[model samples]
Target chain A: MNVAKRNNVTVTGQRGAPVVMLAHGFGCDQNMWRLVVPALAEHFEVVLFDYVGAGRSDLSAWSEERYASLDGYARDVVEICRELDLRDVTFVGHSVSSMIGVLAAAREPGRFARLVLVTPSPRYIDDGDYRGGFSKADIEELLESLDANYLGWSATMAPLIMGNPDRPELGQELTNSFCATDPDVARVFAHATFLSDNRADLAAVAVPTLILECTQDFIAPREVGAYVHAAIPGSTLVTLDATGHCPQLSAPEATAQAILSFTGAAP
Target chain B: MCRTEQEQEPERAGGDGSLTQDAAFTALLEDSAVDLYENAPCGYLSTLLDGKIAKINSTLLAWLGYTREQVVGRMSFTDLLTVGGRLYHETHYAPLLRMRGEISGIAFDLRAADGSRLPVLVTSAVKTGTDGQPLLIRTSVFDARDRRAYESELLRARKEAEEARREAEEARLRAERERERLQNVLVTLQRSLLPPVLPEIPGLETSAHYHTASPDRLGGDFYDLFSLGDGRWGFFLGDVCGKGPAAAAMTSLTRYSLRAAAIHDPDPVTVLTTLNTVLLERYTGREPRFCTVVFGVLEPEGEGFTLTLASGGHPPALLLRAGGGAEYLPTPGGVLVGVLPHPPFTRTSTVLSPGDTVLMYTDGLTEARVDSGRALFGDGALLDFAARLAPATAKDTITAVTGLLHGFGDGLDDDTATMAFGVPASGAAGKPA
Candidate 1:
């Protein structure tokens, strides 16, 4: 399979410039990078793609065994890098994709130059001595809510989301394809994202990393960000003034400025 | 009314008829807006991007049983949810809404002023300003108490189905164990029906074998060697037409009757004739019991035995000679025993000289299948086998035929009973063939 076509990869910006690959988090697709991409494209070549089973990427490539863990997603990222012959690349990831980037960078250290984690959490379940912000039962209830909501979302959005891409609607319909996914695949993706524990993998990330912590992020709180920053060596920590979990959507200008400063791209 | 208002407006300078009508319409619209916001079916609220409550409808306040003064500008949106609902909302719901700019059907439990939990479905959207910046979050909520009740019922039904499937699997396993126990009991009973060891006849070597086609169903084939009287011995090999307890009972009767009749008369033909009369008389008007048998009486003669055999629709005996040659001692024209009242039997006599072996068997040998039942191990194959083992003792003959039967594997589907008698060549008892 062509890795670039499987992920619906779209590359833009200056030719032969430093590569910046942007990956979206759960509950969204590659379209979530709309606000941050325009600013980064000025100095660096920006690469964007959807994970398998999301957005306009091919859903036929999905299988239960290959995607049973975050490692499966990490393999896709490494394959994407290999397919596009990317090196010294700056990987920008949001939410769960942040950990995927961590795993990928640790596996292929020579290919990545720096890492940017947006509201990343190494562990979401709260342990005895650590506050990861959620309990095991809470995650179960969240899965139930997703099950109910995904059923409703599929029914209301299938025609407008799946078919409208070919024959574009003139007006009225929202163009952004966030949270557009098959409900079955979304269920498996949710389990893989929320239940993963990559705390031990933090110290193995030899590349320079920047942890972009949103001020009032409900998903990854400030403490989790501090724990990650402390674990990864030679990593910088910047707390944004954004009020929500997704600064890329809620506060994109601040998000772009942080990425530019950390990677030494022109502001 | 317009003309009168227009005339009166002229008196009150600068007061036009349209201006008076506009004031009245504005008053009506204001009253309708207040009533609609307060009494809409769904609850409405607006929160600052930080999640602090900015405004709330009277409908929501009524549902929570809280007054406006206690909630507005005081409680945040997540503060109203139960502990579990708050955790879920913070982790999943908020992230989704922030990324998508909107979220729908987020189920939560709101803790009311009286401490009772109220189920609700909430949808929220970020309200943006003209500069495309989010100003506040607008939310609408609907009661989901009925839907929660339905989901719980569905969960209960699923659990019940899982329980029933587990019980059915256990029941099937128990039935399989019971069948295994009964099969073991049948095997024990069948083993007891055959002789534990063949009897030793002086001056002659004897061997025998019995192979059952099924372990659960009792086989009807039987063979025995017994002393008659006064330098004489009687032996017989037979197969009943049917199987199980009925045929087993007939086999026992035939065996005892043959020995008794041979002792009284000491003649092979008369002994079989007596067995035919006994079976035909016992089962005349009932289920007709029948069998094919080869009965023999032997007398000692000069380091060997002289044998007289009677056949009743049975396969012929093979004589392996002392000079390394083998042929069948045919006893033709014999009727099937126990089927007719006066069935004539055929008698043939042969001498078991030193190094000579005589084998008597039921049709189960020639009728045995080979190659997964595609072909039969016919009588022609048995004839060639005996000729190859010429100058053989009784034990050697029986051992070779048993080995041939074992080679059939699953193809041998019938019970076989065979008996072989020889003179052992005087001094060849201790040597291997």
Candidate 2:
């Protein structure tokens, strides 16, 4: 098994510098970090990869039995790091991947040096006093929403959005290839991401951690971010001025600045 | 009349009439342009880069149950979406639009002012400025109530089809397993109708083979060699008519009846007569069962064997001579057993010298098709084949005949049974004669 090819791992930046591996959450691929990669690349060795079943990764490697839970995704991360022999790495995860990094770091503590969780949520559904920010019915409605947008990931609608005749150059880079995943794989990943409760996994994080939260995010509310920060001992929390759950796209500069400052790589 | 006269007076003043017509046409065109934008069938909107609603047509406002004052500059696009739709828009829709600069035909449900959900299909494009810099976004919304209903119906139908296909595959597998189990049972029953191993006579060598054409149906051919008593052996080979369970039942009765009769009376003719009586009494009905058999008694006579054979409509036995020749021991005038109460049976006697063998068989061998099913391997061919194997030992002859049967391949479509017995020559203990 070629782990790099299976996960679509892309390595860039100074070859010998400190490694910063970015793991994307559900719904999108490593292309979600396109805006933040340039700034991070100049100071450190930046690694980008799409989890199996997302982006241009080998989708055949995906199995419903393995990917039905977050453990399967964490295995993908562990294998990629082992394949590259990465050491003392800075792991940055967005959305649900924040907990995925916690799992990977706990499994192989020596491989990861620091962890950066962006708009993180350990759990999506609200518990009694924890307030993870959603109801059980809302998650069911989210699955319904995924079914309604089945055409959005289908080939028919992808070409319409990707093929820009007026701007032919834009069509070159964005060719029917953006978030188009297999519908079955997408459904399983949705179930894994929205229904999972990983609050217990946070206490096992022993590495230095930084939590980046957006000021106003509906998916991962500020309370959820505070919960994640308090759960992990000695973790730093920084709130960006961005509005949505994805600060890397909404505020790329601030997102990169916070990551570089935590790693002490910014000159 | 007064209106018609007044209308015609304007046309008479043609120079002024042209100016008046131009003014009315310009007024109509101006009114239509504004009306088309405000009252188009679909809704339209433009938003800033952050999705703040900058401009919205009246048609979309009416669909949302929001007035122009409440919508513009007050709520972003996500505010109009349902909770699930908002998460989808932020996580998937907006990210895709940011990467591709445009996205279309994405399904989302919008929350109206009264908290009702309205399913809609949205297409949005980024409006860049002259310097290729960032700008606002233009969007179009189409009501998708009917299309959503149709799509859900298609999804449900697809699920049902998959379920039906899985069930059909399971049924086919179950039927295959059942057929295998039945074939196993038939094979076990077929073995029970024959001797487990041929009895070893004092001064003779014997071998037998049975070829079944199909495993699914039980074959009716049976052969056995059993000791009667006082240095005498009773042997028989026969085939019951028809195939399957009915013929199989009759074959079982015929084999046991022949054995019991031989014990009572070792004479070949008497043993066959008793079997005939037993079959006729038990299976005489609308679908009458019958069989053809050759029963024989063999006893050692001065270093060789004297075989007394009786046939009831069965094919004659082949005798291979020690002097390199073969011929059938004819038993003429025999009628089929069990069909009549007093049917005549033919009886014959033959002396087997040193190294001479007698082979008895069912008609399935001689009747096998040959030459690509264009001809039958008849009695003449069997005689010729036996002549080639003349002066051969019993085991060698049976092996050669089994090879010949296999050579028929698919042409041999019936069950065949062959049994051979011979006395060894002087200087060749177990070698072929």
Candidate 3:
């Protein structure tokens, strides 16, 4: 565990660019941003770290009672930024961590200057007035698949969750990040990610936020991006041309440019 | 009245009887026709070939929200149909009626009193005079709302049943795929615990076989033969009690411990004792596990070999001699390996002469149930089997036994594992002859 942390994160490019903190979705750790790093690193300061029960972090530290809600993960993002004493931070999050970063930035508004959310979905289940694209039956299908096959579920569910597999190798490396964690940890995170609902917290985020929505993303539909834009007072909403859940891996250059533009950093 | 009396010429003269009767009958028929037309069970009407209303009944007028005078010479039959129905009648019903001189049982919708659609079945026939010239058309209409509703319901229920059947088929396919996946895992795991092929000992004729009753569930029987020390070898055959993943785990544990213990001490009896201790230590309390194992150490002597055999509540090994007879090797007072702290394991010595074979098997073979009477193949049957194949080599003996096991049909319910060893005659080593 110590050795993995000792291998310092590989940060490229000139150091003057604003440091961007990259956080991962559930069932994945920091390694998911590996493919996106080479493209963004040339113009930004990149920071990556594993959530406590993920990647190479110590597994003994995980407690069901503590990490039951995503608040525990949200605090860790804020703590990492505070430990480094970073300013004007641009926090980029994928899936559930998108809102995690939102909660963290809302707590310490001065620490982060901007937020970039990719394939962000605030709620997975449907509400009375909102359609999150998943039904109660669809969630049960996802649960059965998780119960049956955990090791290869990302591979099986990627094309379904991504909404487009014809391009191929979309999110393949990001899914490999899932394999690096223990299977048991992946199971717990899968439950936590799909069951969380945080639509109400979008209004609390005070940073200048830009949500990167894939036009045909099965995870977060275009309408959901509009919902986020509607709730977050002055947040910018931009739609990517790509059609998968993880457009960061599908079209990294476009995603990197969007993140750079949102932070007001010269790309 | 005065003119009628004068015109009534000669009321005498038999009174043209036939003519009076015809006049009275014709008057009665005309009255009945008018009554039936006004109160018929179904709507009845006649239209010209051009579809102009020439005659209509009271019932037909009431159904169409029109009075008899309003429709009798004003509207056409097609005007009473809905838009699509009118189009269908124009394109299909009119052309077919012209050719066939009649059309019947055509389903259609008609505009009703409240401007709502009333589903109806209609039959129309074109009338022709005796001169072969077309005249007016007679049409009959019946209410069909009940039948239409019933047909729609039946179609809906049939569609729902088909969807249910498709879902069941998909679930069955998923279940089959899951079973295949588990079987593949079990086969791979089962292979890992046993040797692909037994080690080729110089003077020993050895062969082993494992038969799985089900591919998806793992069998608890296992066997292996490997070199122990300088010219001394060790082999063991054992059967755990249960089935499924738990038994598979025990099989793996027993196999690894036997190999590890044999490497620690070359003695077969001591290795079996060590495995007993391991099993006792690991699974002694709740849900304790036990197996019946036979461990043997074969040492080379002069022309042939001698073996030291120990039994842990397992079946007695059978020895077949070259003299065309077989006997059971005695290892008495043995108990199951993991049940007690210090279970007594009995050891015995036996020599393999030229063309002599020894067989070891699990109880799955002998205890196989036969018929409804619950008769078992039993120890007697196995002994008889061995005696019948007295002069056979180890390979032939195993081949014969496996064939016999296959012949048990439905009797053999559990998995079977058998191991046999023999010493070839010095001259006939290469060929069966």
- Give the TM-score of chain A, superposed on the true chain A, for all candidates in the order listed: 0.91, 0.91, 0.82
True contacts kept of each: 0.24, 0.59, 0.00
lDDT of 3: 0.75
* Most DockQ-accurate candidate: 2
If chain B of candidate 1 is superposed on the true chain B, what is its TM-score? 0.67
Residue B94 error, candidate 3, Å: 6.5
DockQ: which is higher, 1 or 2?
2
| Candidate RMSDs in order | 11.6, 5.2, 23.0
DockQ (Cα-based) for each candidate: 0.15, 0.58, 0.01
Runs of candidate 3 with Cα error greater than 4 angstroms are A1-267, B1-30, B45-56, B67-103, B126-137, B426-433
Top-scoring candidate (lDDT)? 2
Error of 2 at A8 (Å): 2.3
In order of appearance, the predictions have TM-scores of 0.60, 0.85, 0.54
Deviation (Å) of B128 in candidate 3: 4.8
Two-way DockQ contest, 1 vs 3, winner: 1
Write the number of the candidate with greater TM-score, choosing between 1 and 3: 1
Q: What lDDT tens digits, residue by residue, belong to model 1 across residues A164-193?
A: 334435112543345546667776887888
Candidate 3, B128-173: lDDT as tens digits: 9999877889999887789857765775687699899999999999
